[model samples]
Target: SEQTNKHLYLFEVLVKNIDINRNLLNDYEKDLVIKNPIRVRIIFSDFYDVEIDEVKDCKSIHLPEPEQVKCHSKMSRTATKEKNGKEKPKQPKQKQKVPEEMMYVKKTSLHSQKAGFSCLFPMEPMEMLEKLKTSSLYFLIFSNMGEDEAKKIIGQAKVDVRKNFIDSVQYASATGEFPTTANLTTSCKIENVFKEVSGRIEVYVRLSCFGKFIMSMFNMLYNERNPANKKTDEEEKKAETTS
Candidate 1:
């Protein structure tokens, strides 16, 4: 399947007080490393705003599948036969990597001494839209900060009608066009706040314009099949009204 440069939608996500352990020494007293842990949950749905019940009870969303992946041959073809009429030994075939749904989380800015987060979905619109519906998306209780910091943030943040108001700085990264602002409404919470935390934690949620994706796909297919149907600026208006 052919792909275009246009992104399905853009998201702006950020985390604060991300540097949890500012002054921790290693076991050998050689280097400072992050020892405290953070946990995050991301939720996606068709509602304009998600609810606390939704995030906690919802199952992980299914990602789209590849349309036309090319499987490569590991070894080059050998000659039909050797001079003595025996086939030459061929190199062993290598395994191909299976494609998986992946998202990248990048730190975009440093707040005071804290760091902010960014995430991107780098797949095509067709594959991306297959499993998605239009509307609300939520990144819940996500933190680059430590467990204590994550707890504080989630606690201070206010939520009304299944929405959380993020008073701290956060926004979506720029896409091909301008990035849209997130309407602060939806349920969000850090997973396992009471339990001990450990390891690298990152989360992402995206709300895409499914209607636009449908229109774009229709236009692309229609234009490709009937190139002659394309009209000039003047004729386009006439065709629109007549059709």
Candidate 2:
């Protein structure tokens, strides 16, 4: 059965955090301290040939303010300044925390048509694996929605599909123990699976297979609705009978 041979790849992308650089904001925005609601737009590219009919290409989500933390760098610089005309020795570099106003956090799933489920990618398992190697996801952050609903871009980030996803699946296929889940943390620098504009993004990914019986039923209904598919199926059935 063709349906039995095909595999459905389901992907769920949960965006966790976005930390924008303070320098990226203009003088007016910096003083206001990001009071406007933050919005994120997500796009998955170079992956599935066909997305679910209900899945939207540009999925947007609103983010709440992240937990605040004092800026360590600013404090350190101030503390280390010359006192009594004596220069203070440089100390070890301290990890800088993103300012509260510049950080946004929202645990929302992207590309999902339902509460917990995302769009299904119907294809051969091998083909899906190959495609996953080159797939990518893009994130666009926006703030300050105007009266016309036009969003101002703050920054952008890109993530590669192969990081924790494809490698785990490949290992599972070889070892026959598929975990069907992976986690990725984006960095401040723009690289594979990293964030850009000095921001961070964390994502939890889930993958699952669709049942064969359900796929068969879907195909049957689709063939019934489309004359081309119906004609092809009938011709195949006739050929099978003659053979």
Candidate 3:
């Protein structure tokens, strides 16, 4: 009875972004895990990204969960005069965007851990370790990038990546930190937007090709505290009764 209060180890997760472009999805190229307590947010990039009819334009997917994301944005530095007051041309600042046009949100969440991580997003470390031996896992990812760029990224990337099916992806930018305003140091920023294919048929396809095998680990010993789960088989019942 005391064990039912415990929670299972959640690993599988899915993150979905509304009105996101095919290019800006970093989740596509990396080996991200989908652990427990996952959250997913869907954003709308301007009115343009929204669909007129809910049937085709609605953005949703049943993908694996993404791992805990430690989002970090450093202060975008600008060109400045040194202590000598020498004019230093600004380093082409990696443009920070506060793109209003593409306002969107991403949805992320976690699920039950069923199989080995190697089977899902196998990479170097995951492969070397036997699937059952290791508790580690990796997940596949999808992007809103154009077919050409998505294809190229998938082609060059070691892991699996791709666009959704029959989907015509459109290119648009959400409003964010423009990196320039009245010569004042532009505060770097970001935005929200969805994606669509330009034209033709683009069926949503999932590829289980590759990824980075960060580690081979076992579920923490403390995770399986629930007596109900621990006693899923009958031998445990006898042990429990004897105890």
Best by lDDT: 2
Candidates' TM-scores?
0.25, 0.51, 0.19
Candidate 2 lDDT, 1-243, residue by residue in tens:
466456455665545445556655567765433545555556665643221111122122232221212111122232345767776855534433433222223223321111111455566656667767766776655564546766556666667767666765555445432335555545433222233344555544456545344456677889889979879878887999999
**Candidate no. 2 TM-score:** 0.51
TM-score, prediction 3: 0.19
Please give the ranking of all candidate structures by lDDT, highest first, separated by commas. 2, 1, 3
Q: Candidate 1, which segments miss by more than 4 Å at Cα?
A: 1-12, 16-39, 46-218, 222-243
Measured by C-alpha RMSD in angstroms, how accurate is candidate 1?
15.9
Counted clashes in each candidate structure? 3, 0, 51
- Candidate 1's residue-wise lDDT over 1-243, tens digit each? 233333444333322222222223224221212222223233444312221111111122111211211121112344457789998765434433322222122222221111122233444444444323332344343333433443322212222311221211012222333333333323333222433222122222223322234434655777678766544433765877999
Judged by whole-model lDDT over C-alpha atoms, candidate 1 comes out at: 0.30
For candidate 3, lDDT tens digit of each residue in 96-198?
3322222122232121111111012222322222222322111122233333443211111011121210011111001111111110111111232232221
> Global lDDT of each model?
0.30, 0.48, 0.23
